[model samples]
Target: MSRFRKLSQSIWHCQYHIVWVPKYRYKVLQGAIAVEVENCIRAFSEQQKCEVIELNVQIDHVHLLVMVPPKVSISDYVGTLKGRTAIRVFNRFRKLKEKPYWGNRFWTRGYCVDTVGLDAEMIQKYVKYQQKKEQVAEQRDLFNR
Candidate 1:
């Protein structure tokens, strides 16, 4: 497809929608903190060879849509991204470490990830219809018995 990304040996198109929250889902991600966080994500993602397609830094959570190459694992990328960004943000704003529940951590333990591909709705509908057909077949078999 035209949207495929080329690698040294492969061509693929893999996009991910990731969501993560700060420690305690605090509203601290605003003003200066938000700006620093955005900078960290952008810079770190560039290092990891991930393209930031879209990013929304909410007060309590962050939503990101990114294109990550197949050579990199999504889990590892998210983990390192969180870690590096936390370090940068804390270094920039030393007072953040003194806040409640800081404990030298910026983000929560894990994140939510989903694949972004073609026609998810169509696939979902096809699965639902298949399930209905199976249910009907089972009912007919039970009646026949």
Candidate 2:
């Protein structure tokens, strides 16, 4: 399919590389929590008419490559994504909302966002490349065995 998306007024391809972590840089995301975060992000993207090109939820941080419409600002999108996902996660995992994570917050106050240009393919690769590398390593290990 074409990378560009069409609206009534414009045809555009705007991708962003966004990364954020839990409050205090905590590595609380894993297993079911990581899975839930991925689902929440996809749900959020769909709600905003955004496309998730790549998403990787790690123990400590999240990497997302998304094609966002021009009407939506990156900061606003990220803020909403963080806020909604935090609420969802915290609600589902009540124990997480207490103690170190005060104020019912899950993610940190800031996130890193960069616009993806013509090199979006490379950027997407970087977004979720760890899994490919690990799979290749596992294959090599199997061959050696």
Candidate 3:
């Protein structure tokens, strides 16, 4: 079921599907470390007042479906998540600090994000059709020239 949150001035439902991986895509996210990471994510989401719709922690990456308020910037929110989790995990697991690959970073500098909603497919189709329109526009310009 879809849910909407209400604020003093506005009611909204803003959701995003976010995916990110650790530095060097290491398969170290397993066993106790994975559990700790998952817990950290849940705690941080609560602190941000964001709802965790769904979460999947793979050996090398994490997939999260979250509902955040409109006031929150997705990039900033993602940065917070990555930064906090990294610090907590490293502190909790000292051995990780000694790993050459880990160095001084936990997550990579890049991440993938997409808005999620009922009209996602429709939006995708619309964007796909824009390419054809651009092609037609280019052709018309060539003919006119």
Candidate 4:
């Protein structure tokens, strides 16, 4: 009975930290593209009926800290998020249609998802910091160049 209970608990109220990269690691998320990606992420969360506690969209990858309901599968959730956002972003950005950005899929085939325990605050801080860290890196790279 205890084992069954543990299994059931695992099925419910699970938190997932997912990361997916852009195809070929293209750094297309610049200027207005980042804002569009943000909006698309919000829309995806709402449409999928999932709770996105934290999300950070970098130039080549996205970090999402989300809670998955018992009925939803992690693979499906990631696929939907990536697919929908790609479509929306491609449609909005004309330049993306040419190459590197829209010539192929927006996201890579595989993603990283980690099951997390109860540490919502820490996860949120990490997600927020990822964005800041990426921005700083970009600035530093530009300065160095």
- Predicted structure with the largest TM-score when compared to the true one: 2
Candidate 3 positional error at 54, Å = 0.6
lDDT of 4 by residue, 1-145 (tens): 3211123456356778888888788888767887888788788777777778788888778889887776778888888888887888788886677875456588788999888776767877998898787778989999999
Index of the highest-lDDT prediction:
2
| Model 3 stretches astray by more than 4 angstroms | 119-145
TM-score of each: 0.79, 0.86, 0.79, 0.80
For candidate 4, the TM-score is 0.80
Model 1: runs farther than 4 Å from truth?
Answer: 119-145
Candidate with more favorable, higher lDDT: 2 or 4:
2
Per-residue lDDT, model 2, residue 25, is 86
**What number of clashing residue pairs does each candidate have, in the order they appear?**
0, 0, 0, 0
> For model 1, how does the per-residue alpha-carbon lDDT over 1-145 read when each residue is reduced to its tens digit?
4888899899988888788999888878888988888888888899989998777676677777788999999999999989998998899889988877789789999899889788544433443354356568889999999
User: Candidate 2 vs candidate 3: which has greater lDDT?
Assistant: 2
| lDDT of residue 37 for candidate 4 | 82
Residue 130 lDDT in candidate 1: 48
For candidate 3, write residues 1-145 as lDDT tens digits. Answer: 5478988899999988788999999888889889888999999999989998777777788878788999889998999999999999999999999978787799999999989889655544443454466568889999999
lDDT of 2 at 133: 74
lDDT of 4 at 77: 85
Rate residue 40 of model 2 by lDDT.
96
